[model samples]
Structure formats: C-alpha cells, structure tokens
Target: MKKTIIVLLTQLVLGLACADTIQLETGSFVTITLPSGWSANLNTSRSNEKVYWINLISPEKNENAGKIALDRLKHGWAATEEKFIEHMSASIERLSASLKEQPVSLNELKTDNAIILYQVLVWEKIVSMITGAGLAEYKGVGVIHIRYNSGHTAMITVPIKTLDNSNELNEILNIAQNMQISMPLSENKEEESAQSSIQITQNEHGTVIGNPDISRVSLLLPSKNYKATPGALAIGRGDPGYFIGRDMVANVIMSGWFSPIYKFKYKTARDLWKKDTPKQAKNLEYLKIKEWDVMVHELEIPIKTQNTLQVTLRANLLEDGTWIDLRLSSMGIASQRADMRKALIDYINTLQVNVAEARGFHLKYTKQGVIINAPAETPGSLFIKTKSLLLQKRKTHIKTEFFLFQDSGEDIKVIAWLRPASDYHYANVKTLWDETRATLSGEGFTVIGDTDCQKTRNWDVMLYDLKTGDKRTRNVNMRASCVSGGIWVDVHFTTVDQRDSSFLRSKLLAYLKNFKVSDSHVE
Candidate 1:
C-alpha cells in the first residue's frame, strides 16, 4: 500500500509538470497539444481551402463558451481569406465613419501570414439565482488571436484584467513575440494577395506645442533636431537656429531687463510715446506677460503632397523642467486657408508637456510670469518668458528669457541674461530697474539702488529673508559689457546654509554637464 501511494504521488507531480511545460512551435507544419483538462474539437467543413483546419478548444470550465463562439464564426463566413480581410476592413471603416468622430490615426502597420489560431479564456463565478440557489456564471472573457501567412504570423493573447495598464499591455506584446507557434500552416497565398491589394502610408513631423496636462507652453521639437542650453539665454537661442526642415527657417532672440513686468512697461511707454499705438496694451497681455518665464516657438510647414495624408508624431525631449507651446503658420501657395486651419488643429491636439523624466517639475503659466514648481527636495526654481516672430514668407524667430531662483528662498541667484544690442536704442533702463525692485519687494527682496542698474552698466542681485523684510546684496556686476553683438549673463549664488549650498552647487554642475551647443547653422 505504501509503494502504491508513492507511485500515485509521482504521477501527480509528472502531470503538473507536463501541464506547465507545454510549448507549441509551428513554422511549416502544425502540431499542438492541449494541457491536461483542456480539450480540442476540430471543424471539418472547409478542409481543402489552403487552410488546414479550424479547432475550438479551452480548459474544461470554458469548453461550452468556446464551442458557442466557434459556432458563431463558422455560420457567419464561408469565404476565402482575401474576402474575409476585405470584409473585416470594410466593417471597421463603416463603424468608424458612422460614429462621426475623428478616427484614431492608425499610424503603424505590420503583416504576417504563417499560421492562424483563435483562443478564448473565460472566468467563472458563482452568483445567487433568482430562486435563492447558487448558480454558475461566466464573469469575464478574453480573446487570443494567432495568424500565420507567407512565412510570418503573430500569436497575441489578451489577459484577463479589470483595467488595462498600457505598461502591462506592452509586456503582453513581448510575451506574444516570444510565444512559439507549433504547427505552421501552409502559406496563405490568398492572405498575401489581400495584403497586396491594400496600401498604407505614414507621415511624421515634429513641432512645438503647449501641453496643458503638464502646464507651461513649451517647445516640443524633436530631440535629434535641437539641443538645449540650460542656463544662458544665448545658449537657449541655439534651439531656434537648429529648427530647420525642408522649406523652413527659424531665428532666436533673448532679452533680459530688471523684470519682464518692467520690460513690458518700458515697451508700453515706448509704444505710447514713440509709436502712439494703443495696441501696446494688447501686446502687454502676450509680450512682457509674466507667468513662469516663457519660451516661444514658431513652425512653418508647406504641404506639397497632392493626396491628403494623415501625419502622426510626438516630440522626444532631451531635458526636463521646461514647458512647451507649439504654433504652426503656413506660407506659400497651396490652399492656405483650409490647410492652415487643419494644421493648427492637429498641432494643438498633439501638444503634450510633462515634467522631464530628470526633474519632475510642473510648469505653470500666468499673466505675471512662467512659474516652475519643482517636486519636493528639488534644488531651485525657474521662471521663463517666451515670445515669437514670423518673418514674411521664409523666416521664424523665437525669443526666450529664463530667471533662476534658489528654492531655499534665502540667497538670490541670477542666471545668464542676454539682450540684443540693437534693442538698446528703445530700452528704458530706469523703469526696468524700478519694476524689478517692486516685483522683488513682494517676494521679500528689498530694492537697493534708486537708479537703473543698466544705466550704470551694472546689474544688481538682491536677497531677502522670509522671517524679516530685511534685504541684502551679495554681488553686483557690470552689464554684458564684454558681450559684442549678443550678450550672455551668468549668475552664481552661494546659500547662507552650507547644506543648501551643496544642493545649489550640485544643480549648477548638473546643468553645465547637460548643456550642449546648438548646431543650427549646419547645412
């Protein structure tokens, strides 16, 4: 009796191993075996139509459900593979068009035709019946589709999940790629012919857009096409230079004054006194508008293709902590009114801005300034201003300004500030400094100089403590006097606390390490 019991236990273990170890590999010949408790039923109707056979199989609990599905498909279509694919495509197109909603852009395509198989997984449940007795129920179901034709086929299985996680969905795709199909059906010549009858095309383009999801309007151009200069405004100018494509030209501008508020005020004064234009007030809302500092991008695309083609694309970012605003303006001959409207809508829909993976900062834009709120423990804050210009039929100019503030709120830090030499003719240095003082005062920094720093050819750095309104200056430097055509400014800060000092130092180092010169002029 003891020997018999041990032998039975060994058989049970062997059965469990066999069930888990089953793998099917199909290339030219088809052979598959179901695990224990699973069964297969073959359909023999269209056995001669190049396709070998159709089978319905499932675990014991789901056998009935699988049979019912097989019955439905068998009754519906007795056509060749080519006809079936046409029917399927037509059905999908009809359903999509009937809804009268924008269809999801189907941008990628792959085809395989080596083997085809169908699988269904069912989850059973026990529920109380109307008669008060427990009844068996089919709670959920998932489908597995396998297709093979012309030496290629895909075996994809959907898992049972209450909610789908895209990351997990990708894992499922990986598993499908790894699955071995045991019985390779004869090449489906009909399927190949059907695929040849259909033509698919894909178009991809990159542009800058505002991603409201992450806040902040940012430049979302392709990573390969542009490089970022982190600290200096002159460095940031390189991005616009690199933004070149067929029939496209881009320019960059960087300006710095005591504050954007004051910059606007100066512009307002010039527009009022010099130009005598009321439009200056409207310009104030967009230009010299504060919120986190702004970066503006302008893209011009000329549609040359005769056939209307759908374009789908996304920007790959090289850095974090910046927001994106994308705008598109069309130039040249072909159908400007309609094409511009369509391009604008597509550009707007494609905008997506989120914290860069390196830094999880949420960028906010307001009329005051561009505000960057870093995740907890982040070392600093960034305020930016961005504006744009489109020059006639061929040129695009983007201007950006950045203001770096220490997250500690203790010491004041000024990064690079660049101002165009040509613009100095119109600039009001006194009002700019006064406006900067007023803004800093609200942030707890007391203004020191009564005269304009720009007039003295010197820039001031102001610091304040939250506990008291007392203000102090760590350093004052001459303006970009060394700067010839364009200016470059760099602000260095040392925190009062040693611990905070290390954090600030580390951030500066990181910024320098990641900074790269933009290659915009390369032909």
Candidate 2:
C-alpha cells in the first residue's frame, strides 16, 4: 500500500511539473497553473486493513481527458445529488460543530463523452479541517464534490477543497475563479442570498463568518469612512493570513491583520510585526499609538505606471495570554498623509466590541492601565474577552482563544493584550531587555535608551524608551525576579516628550509591584 501510494504521488508530482492544465481521469480538461505534487502517507493498523492518504492531490489527467475540467465532475454527483449533500453535511460537521447547515448548489456540465455533476456547498469552517488524499486546510470550505458516470462507465469521485478566511469576500472571489458553468452563474447564485447577507457565530474556534462560511475576525467601519478591501482573488490558496475587515477606498485605506503566537512563529507581537515589515522600509521609528506602542514605516510602490505611497504600522498585543501581532496599513500619497493618519487614529479609537453585528473587539488602551483577572462564568466555558472578576478554577481548563483585554466599561474598547508568562520565554531580566531591544532595532525601531538596575537582591528592573514620535515617548518597564520563577512583569507606559521620566518611572515600578497573574488557565 505504501509503495502504491508513493507511485501515485510521484506520478502526480511529475504530472504537475509536466502538465500545465489538469485533465481529470474522466476525460475533461480544466485550466490552472501547475500545482506542486501531493503529500502521501500510508497508515496500517494491527489488522490487515491499510489506509493511504494523499494531500494536495491536485495534479492529474487521463490519456483521454486533456486536463481537469468542470465537465469531468460527473461521477457520483449525478447518482447521489441528495446523497452527496448528506455526505457534505456530515463532512462539514466533522470540520467544526460551529458550521451551520449552509445551502448547497448543484450544477451539471455536459461534454462529448460524459456528463459532470458538481456540487458547490458554501459553508464556514472556523476550525481548520484537514483530509486524506491531498486535500489540505479548509476554513470557509467550498467542498466541491463531483460525482458522475457516463451511464456505461464506472462512477468517479473528484473532491476539491479550498481554505477561505473571509466569507463574502472569498465567496465572490470563488465564484469568479471557479464558477465556469456554461449557464449564467449569477442567475443561479442569485437564487440564494448575496454574500452581503453575512452572519457571524462564535464557537470553539476564535471567530467565524458565514454566507459562504469561512472563519475570520470582523470589524465594523464608519459608514462613509471605509469599506471592505476591494479586489479579486486569484486561484488556489488565494492569500494567507486571516484579515478581519480590511477596507481600501480611493487613495486612503485602513486594514488590520493578525498572526497567532502559539504557532511559535514569533516571540511577541512586536517581533511578529517586525518580521512582517517589508525590507524596503528600514529605519522606521517606534511610536506610542492610542492602543499600544507601534513601529511605523512609510514606503512607496509603483502600481501599474502610477506611484502609490503606503504607510504601515505594527504593534503587539496579548489576548488571553495568546501573543498576536496586529498591523494597520495606510495607502495613498504623502499629500493625504495627515488626513489618512487622523482617520486611522479615529478608526482605531472607535473600534468597539459589537459581536452581535459580527464586528471585531476593539479595546481601548492607555498609559494608566489595570491588571485584570478575567474569571470565567462556566467551569470550562471559553471566553475571548477578559471580564469575569470571580476566580475560575478547573483541573481541565484549557484556553481555546487569545487573551483579550479592553478598557474598563460596558462598551469595551481593546487597546492591548497583556501577554501572560507562558507566551514569553526569558532566562533573566538583562537577557529579556537586551533581546527586546535587538528585536525592536531589527524591526526598524531605534532604541532611544535602555536602563537596567538591581535596586535590591530580590529583583532587577529594566527599562527601554522607544520614542519615535516627536510628541510622546513609549516606554516599557520590566521587573524580573526568581520568585515568580524567572518571570518578568512588563508594564507599558507612555509619557509626553521631554517630560521628566520621573512620573512614568514611578508608575512602571508601581504597576509591576502591584500586579498578579490570574488562575493561569484558559476559561
């Protein structure tokens, strides 16, 4: 079985390199650039039964069929239109319990030798789902299951999976990229609600969106100020990273993107931001933003024959102890710089929690902050926002989402995430301070100054001033001690430029001295 799977994988890889177009085994051709080979593995149990799994199983074609075509998705599809839906439903459930019973659409394409039945089901997979046989990550999965037989021939099964992070945006892009039916696609798709009728639901996964069912973090924009990023997706795994709702209008654009910390992809949000910053914009300055201290860079790129300027801002925030790097991009010309900057600041300031409307969590942050212990209401219930004051202790409590912190009030406005000790790994205070500065410098933020002192034998204090703005200075204070088991209590503070650091210095020590870690478990 292993050998057989290897042979098939090798063939697929070769076919991908040799065949620009995909010729389905059923004798139909579809056009797409060559996809790399598939990943295959064989699993055998104690019994004689063996299962072979192939991943990315895209490249294939038959001697008769030139390449993969919608016309070839005609095997089991024709016989089991109803049964196919049942299977798709079951498969969706397997992907994530949060996914709704999304609507399924079926279309048929007739070719010379065979009739292809393609089932296009739009649903969300908040939690990523992986499958055997070369099918990879699927989030807002468009489970395209094709099955049909030419009456005299045996039935065929061709399943394709796509991972989409946003629903409406992705659905529209998917239709443009994949809807190749001879019939007018808009006519059939209109029978169902447009992608604009989007809905969001929370589950074990962090966030999810529907109307094509892909998982994403969403935020509401000021009606006239901004809109969802406008563009078209180009085939395959279109783009990576889950963007909430990025809006780009005319010359000015506001967008937000995030990277998960648990992936161990980066040390902190700052590190994540720095790593993502383009190489062209080096020597950027770190400044104090409304929510968190951010590193800002300005760059100019040529779009078509015209020149466009873009300013990128990056910051670090912790959600439920999960480290997340957040980014905001301003695009247009330097002439609109001041307008876009003010608008960007206003937009971030207005971000509030509106989950009911499928909006994102925008918490407010300031120099004077609180150390909150967000207790859970239920024993094992998962909470994204930090709120509960009562202690929640459970033997099996595991955090399923990032730790979210907002300003104190009913209308929670998020500014920053105070990452727990678990997210940061530092041997000592000096190492933490020095490494942080190195990282900031690498990300283009100039380390204005650094201070380290051992006031007492009990603990050591460290400070770094990353002041990029002419009006303010963003300072971070770290007090590390062996008592907390090599733990560092990092307090972020901002002060008006040229003001004596005396006030902020005292505030930092006070915040660190008076803070405590909560139950230390995810609610």
Candidate 3:
C-alpha cells in the first residue's frame, strides 16, 4: 500500500506541472489545457484587403502532434454571405494541398453549446510553412480539422485519442467552438487614463512681453489691393536699423501685422487739421484718391483714422543687463503733413523692450554705435553707417544723415556704403566721394583712389581704398547715379585685423544676400 500511494503521488505531481491552459473570450468564455512541454504560436494578418487570425499549438515532446486554428471570415460580409462561404471553401482546398494532406472524412457532432462539423486528416509527412503547419500521424497521433463561420471563419486542429471513438472527438469540438476571445477596448482605456495624468507647467515670472529698445515706424501706401513690397527701411545684423536677435525682432514685427488695424494716422490727421482749420473745412471740396475701390475725399487728409494700429512686444533676460526693444508702427494713409507726423508718433508707441545678459563679445547697433563691455574680445569695435539720398533730375539731392559710434577703446574704424545709381546729386557727389575717402583714411587704410570703374547702360561703378598710412590701399567702390534700382549701404568693422576683418566681411556679405527690406526678413 505504501509503494502504491507513493507512485500515485508522483503521477499527480507530474500531471499538475505539465498542464498548460489557453483562454479566449470573443463572446463566450472557453479554455483548453495542454501538456506543459508544448509551444504555441499566434499569427495575425491585416491589410486593406482582409484580416485573419491563426493560432498553432504543438507538443515539444511529440513534434508531430501540433494543430492549427485559423479564422478567415470576411470582416463585414452580411450582404454577401454566399461569397464568404465560397471563399472559405477555396482557401481550405488550397491550404490542404499546400500542406500535403488528404482529408480522411467529414463528421458532424452536436454539443450543448454548438453543432460542429470536423474533417479528419492523415498525412505521410509534416510540412512547415509561414501560412500553416502540418504534422504526420504517428502510432498515437491524429489530426482533427475543425472549421466554423460566424462573424469570422476559424479552423483548429488537435490530436485525437487513437483508441477513443467519435464521442471523445465531439467533446473536443464542443470546447473549441465555445471558446471566446477578448477585445482590446479595455487596454485602450487604460492607456488614455495614463496619458491624462501628465501635466505641464509654464514659468510666469521669467520675462515680461512687449518691451523694446528700438522702435519702428511703418508706412503703408494706398494701393488698389493689399500689396506687400520691401519696406522703406531694412533691419538685420548689418542693416541701418539692424537688431541683434533677428528671430525675436522678426516675430514681434509679424505679430504686429496680425493685430487689428487701427486708423491712428487718419485720427491724428483729422485732429490736427481740425485745430488748424475751421469746422467749415470739413465740407470743403478736396481731391480724391482711389485704393481698393474705396475713395478718400481728401488728397491729403489729416493722419487720423479709427482703424489705425500699433503694438509693442518686450522680453527680459536679466535684471541689469542690456534690454531688447522692438517697436512696430503701422500708418495706413496720411493725407497731410500733420497727419504724417501724428502717424509717426502713434506708430512709435508699438515699440517692444526686452532685457537680457549679453552673450556675444560686444553689443553693436548701426544707429546707436558699438558698446564694448568686454575688453579681451578680439574683433574689437565694429561700426556701420547708412545714408539714403534722394536725387531729382540728376542734379538736386537730399542727403539723410545716419551716425556710427564706438564705445571709445579702439584705435581703428572701417565704414562701407552702397550707393545706388539713382541718387546722384551732382553738387553733393564730390562731397560724398570726399567724405568716403576721409572716413577710410581716418581709420588707417592707405587711400587707393578709384581702383575699379565701369559704366553699364544703367549705372557707373568706382572703387577706392584706405590703408595703414603705409603702401597698402584697400580698394572701395562708388557708382554714379541713374534710374535703375534703389541703392543700399553696408559698413562693418571700424577696427579689425586680417582675421577679424575677414570674419566681419563675410558676415556683412551674408546679411546683404539674405536680407530683405520687406516685412519677410528671413526665409
């Protein structure tokens, strides 16, 4: 009795250790237990054309006793159920040939949950493929092919008890048909809940918006439609109104345009014109200008309007360092001189100011000059001067003075300018040429006067130079004025050695090539 009890206990332990259960729940729940020393493979196929799920189970100890479960029902086929049945039949026939298996017989069995039709198969050799797996029936192995159709068609195979009759086969079919597969909806819900738990915080005390150091005054001429051209002024690293932080300045300008239009020019003009003239002037006849099919009663109206707009945006970097300022002005149309003046004032109000610790070696501005806060800097002081001259009839000239300065430690200066052929005031031409020479000489370049000169159909070109009061004369160019495109000037590096000079020169050329006078500054 002791020996028999010990043997029985050992068999029980082995059976418990070798048990493997697979549970599925598409609708009804069902489970199957297999020996522990077995492997299972699950495969899925999905595309725009169709979707399928196949599960294969095989014993590791008895390699030939593996079975496959396949589901091939069309995802949505209620309208053409016959087509689905035909497709399944064709698919199964092809699959059987591919597996080198001959269907032994088809048998039907009814259970408490489902009525199952199963095909028994016996093959001479096992075939392994990506689509399906086959197994040979040995002394104790049998293959049971079970297929069903509901929302989908599924086929499963398992080893049959060689000695048991059809009653045992029917029992396996009942369990397989009633098995359920769970949907992924619960997993999706859990993921969404996890994502919702995360939050983001913004720093409120870091910097204030809309403060600017330099301001801009924008004038929009009356056109037939909304048209955009290069602005009257350009700002960049090298331009006359250049800003150090190009991206910040560009953003502020663009934001100003997006804001609602305020007709401050019209309002200011009307206010000034009203104070100067009597109430009767309101009814006086005036010249009309047409823009966008809208008529303005006065050729020169007071620069006051209800739709004028301006904006100022600012950023702060540190408590005591330099601040960035950006001012944007929008003047729609100014009828009179007073209107123009008032519009300028209103536009300047849009300037934005920002403060930040300096990152680069020096702070430079075309109009404010250069400020050297660090002495060990190599490039030293760089200054730029820009002037726009309006020439009429090739004789009359109007020169606009623009200044450049250095925070006084440097011993040298360099100033470069671009003269358009359209602005040749004959009287001031000689004076401007002389000023260019004097400026270069004062900076220490040997004056090599007129190294390059050429006259195209549109304009004339001239080059001059300044050296270290020595034999070397740096070549500079001046072009005679004619009616072609407008001219621009670029001056960089008031004091620089060969290395620094080349660096500054490259930076200036890059600015000119990419720079635009238009509102769109960077591409």
Candidate 4:
C-alpha cells in the first residue's frame, strides 16, 4: 500500500532542514518553505481523477484555528483566469451552503502568472453555556491559482487571518510563484514500487533484514556461503540479508518469529496477498505445507551489479503473530536463470526454522507488586541496571521501576509502574487509560492510532501507541490492573527507531501476557 507523508515545518524553522523537497507517493514532487507550528500532509487518493493535494494545519487554540489546502488538478479545466475565478466562486458557494451563512469576498488580485482572492466568513463561536457567553469570529481565507504553461494546473488555499501579521504569507506566495510540478520518470516509479513491496524502514542498526510487518519468525539461512559483517549479529547480519547462490551470486534474506496466530488479520494466505499485493508483482499465489500457509510473489528490484534483479518473496504469518519471510533474488541474466531457479528450490527445501520461545528472565519485586518475564540478554544485547522513580497526581504517588534494554548501539526502556489501589484516579481500566493518555499528552506526546483495551484472566490490559511532536520518537505503553492486588501496573516500551518499534512492542505484549499478581504481595 502507498504510504502518506506528513512533514512538519518546525524542522525547517529549527534549522534541521534547509528547504526540504518532498516526493509524494503518487510520483509528484512538492517543495515548500514555511514557518514553525505548521505541518503538512500530502494526499493523492482523491476520488476525482487523481487529484493530488497537500493539507496544511496551523497551531490551534480552543479549536482548530487554521486550515489550508493546495491541490494539483489532473484534467477538465480551462487555462483562462475567468474560469479559475468561477471555480473559486462555486467552491465558496458550496462552503456557504454547508455553513448556512453567506461569506463576502474582500479582495482579488489577477496577474499574468497567478490569481489571488481573499474572503471573510463571520460566525458565532460558543464559549460557555454556563456563563451564557459567546464570541463573534471573523475567519479569512485566501485562494491562489497558479498558471503553469507546462500543462500543470494547481491551486492553493491559506488562512488569511493567521498570516496577516507575519511574513509567512509572503513565504507562501513565494511558493506559489516558484513552484514546479512534474511526473516521476518511468524507472523511478519501478524502483519505488520495488522498495514499497519489501516494506522495510532502514535504520542505523546494521542492514535491516526481512520485513517489519512480519518480524516474529527467523530463518536458518545457509551460513557457509554467507559471512556476517562485523558487529551486526546483534540485529540482522550484513545489510538486509546475506548473498547466496552457488553458480550465480544471488541475494537472500530470511526471518521469522513464533506466535499464536497471524500478525494483523487475513484468515488465509490468499486473503493476505489480495489485501496488499503490489501492482508490479508477478505470479502471485499461495501454498500450504502441513501446518503452514505460505504466500508467494515476485518483483524486479534494482541492484548494484545489474539494472534489475527478479526477486521472489515467500511469506507465512501465522500463530497469532509468528511469521516467516524468505526473499531470493537473481540478477537478470539469461545464463543465470536456470541456476537461480535451482538455487531457490534448494534454499526452500533446506530451510529449517526452530520454533522456540524466546529466553526471558522471570522478574518480581517483594514477592508481589508487578511480576513479568523480561526478555533475556542475547548476543550483542544486555539489560542495564534497573532504575526507579515516583510520579505524583494530586496527593497520590505512583512508584515506577524500569529496565533499559540495549541492542547493538540502540536502546529502549521497559518501565513498570506501581500505583495505590485506592488512587480512585485509576479505579478502572478506562480511567487508567484516560489518566495515562492525559499525563503523556502533558509531557508532549501524542497518542497514535486507536488505544486498545482487552481483558485477560486476572487483569485488564490497555495498549497505547504514542509519538512526539516531531514524530521522531515512539512509545508503546501497556497498562494492566491486577484483580486482587492493591496495585496497578503499566509498562512503557519506548524506541526512537521505526525498525525496532514492532519488535519492542511484541516483547512488551509478551510481558503483559505472562504477567501475574502474587498472593504474598500487598500494596
């Protein structure tokens, strides 16, 4: 599936980026310079004739204060300035009808290369019904139509009230004056499709092998023919995976993890393939081997040794989240075709996966409190010294203890919190989640996606995904309540790298699943 790009202008204003250029998933390029407290998301999934748009949001108070949109039209429009004005008028008419109020146009500017129009809408905003107070709001909108002679047609809408006092309006006008739009070259499209098919987000931790979506299982790749790069054994060996093939050098990366059922959804392999099978994929099919259902597909990926390599991917996501991903690729050469086929078969037949539970440490404090099976130390990874802290809410205090897991050079913390049973603030799981989300939000973290709540045998579990304002860091929190113990517990699994997010989250869930409330412990 094509992914949407959300870019924050704060990075540009903070000097982390010097006028960055972003490429949309639809093969269109966008270059914009904006001030802080603004963020943009590109959407190319419009229902009308492949219309591409960028939605801009400004910092809000009380409610969303500013909204701006810029869009590139694909077809059905005249180049004349009059036609553009008519389109704007019709759009305003629709908005007026939806709001049940008439808006007045304040100003207009027509130039050889662009057209700008300003409008104002007057409305009443409800402040407080208890105090019988309301305020009149004047919202101003600016529309800009750009005339590109190269057959590219586009329009931009901005919030006039927010930009009236700052230089930001001039900067936005500069973008309209100098914007350039073009379709990506054919070769670039193919490369992008190939990269999307693999769906691995590269990070600083060695070469990312296999796919993050199916991170559970591991494959016993042929080792004699492949050598591990220095210090990369902690994560995945080499970049991506090791090279294979006897007569012809081919690439292969295999990974799998054990679980109780499939990772996301899809009851069958065919169903999974139908859900996200890339457009460029070939020979898409499903297979079954005793207890495992396998989905297979092929794509042409660009490589250094050749213009393109035909890659075959075999995947099996089962046992809750347990999965296996095996990728084999051969450089496009007529002479290597036969050898590649034989090598692929050999690798598949010889593939041996040892489905075993991960090693972990059974940890507890004072014979009770929060008990969990923390993931044990593996090669190139270790747990640092445990730490403790206290958080205050009103007159209540919650004690927190945590262990930091460090792999290769990257690190993530696993925190466990102990709260009083009579805190009342967390009398139930729903209130627990509300308190947790509110606290995290106050600390500058935004909850991502939907927060989930489920009931276990002896505890109520709540899962949350959170990210920072810049979207660079992420935390997966699991909060649980013991049935009889006079304490509440939660674990925060935090990671800065996207590649490790899934792995760390799964580990946290494992801990939650094995959690126990000891009878000897009392709050």
Q: Could you say which candidate leads in lDDT?
A: 4
Which candidate would rank higher by TM-score, 3 or 4? 4
TM-score of 2: 0.30
Error of 1 at 438 (Å): 34
RMSD of each: 28.1, 23.5, 35.5, 21.9
Report the candidate with higher lDDT, 2 versus 3.
Answer: 2
Q: Could you tell me the lDDT of residue 31 within candidate 4?
A: 50
Model 1 TM-score?
A: 0.19
Candidate 3 has its poorest 10 consecutive residues by lDDT at 2-11
For residues 1-523, what per-residue lDDT tens digits would candidate 2 score against the true structure?
0111111110012333222222111111222221233222222211111111222232242111111222212111123345544544454453332223434454545444444344433433222211222112222233334332322112122232332323322222222233222111112233112222233334443333322211122333333434333221111011122233444442343433222233334454456555555556734767665545567676654333344556666655443222234456666655666665565555455543232321121122112322332323311111223221111111112421222221111111122223333555666667767776787679877766547555433445565556543333333334333223222233333322223455555644554443343333222
Off by over 4 Å in 3: 1-104, 110-115, 130-150, 159-171, 181-523
Name the runs in model 1 displaced over 4 angstroms: 1-327, 334-337, 340-344, 355-523
lDDT at residue 476 of model 2 (Cα atoms) = 39
User: C-alpha displacement of 510 in model 1, angstroms?
Assistant: 31
Q: After superposition, how far is residue 258 of candidate 3 from its true place, in Å?
A: 47
Question: lDDT per residue, candidate 3, 458-493, as tens digits?
Answer: 333334433432121222223332322233333333
For candidate 1, the per-residue lDDT at 74 reads 12
Worst 10 residues of 2 by lDDT: 1-10
